[model samples]
Target: MAISRITTVEVTSEHIGVKGEPNISYIYSRYYRAPELIFGATKYTTAIDIWFAGCVLVELLLGQPLFPGESGVDQLVEIIKEKCVEEDYEI
Candidate 1:
């Protein structure tokens, strides 16, 4: 299978304001949203796009979303589960 890549076109956008600006709208697909965005961070950097690119890369490798959350909160939970949960830890 061909590995899909995230191109500049897929990641380009024209959001108003620069980094550290307050109350910036959270406008991103939930599956590819950065952790900062999920945490309601208004002042964020372009690093969020890098996070999105990583998510896309993971999906391309696994053929599914790394964090397949149904909602915003669920997305956070998925991230926490992946990062914080131990191999022996039970739900």
Candidate 2:
């Protein structure tokens, strides 16, 4: 499988793990959610996570995400219809 640019990865049922971004984020600190990711002292005095939990809670009541996508960028786009700018899309 390594030939012709094809590759194979082996996994066991018990070894399953997520292959993309981490959900835990200093950037995604629970106290901030708006049009963009805000950092630093701006993250203070606002219960950002509480807001997100409220949003998700509402979505759950509706039986779906208020917004959903196949990737994190897609998910963000669904949120505000704008791309997350200046990201270095590298491994």
Candidate 3:
């Protein structure tokens, strides 16, 4: 299968929170979360959505999530692993 285009459907509720409020409870899906969100950044831009779009595109290309994590920590681990591999650094 091939992905010609990607569309942003309804934004997840995790991305919706009151400004200046502590965003410790809700979070985006682990597989598609942006790095900042993973790092507990409550103040972020729409770029997070763009990051999620990129992840979805990658999933479409690879036939699976590029980051298939089970939890927040697991998600960070997957990202770190990918970064280490890319930089040719030992983890």
Which candidate number maximizes TM-score?
1
In order, the Cα lDDT scores of the candidates are 0.74, 0.41, 0.73
Which regions of candidate 2 deviate over 4 angstroms? 1-47, 82-91
lDDT of 2 by residue, 1-91 (tens): 1222322334455433233423223343222243333222332223544556665565546555555555555555555542333364321
Ten residues in a row with the worst lDDT in model 1? 4-13
Ranking by TM-score: 1, 3, 2
State which candidate, 2 or 3, has the greater lDDT.
3
TM-score computed on alpha carbons, candidate 2: 0.37
lDDT of 3: 0.73
lDDT of 1: 0.74
Each candidate structure's TM-score, on Cα atoms with residue i matched to residue i, is 0.70, 0.37, 0.67
1-60: candidate 1 lDDT, tens digit per residue: 865554232434555436666644355678888888888788767787688779878888
Candidate 3: residue 58 Cα off by (Å): 0.6
Candidate number with greatest lDDT: 1
Model 1 segments more than 4 A misplaced? 2-17, 22-25, 87-91
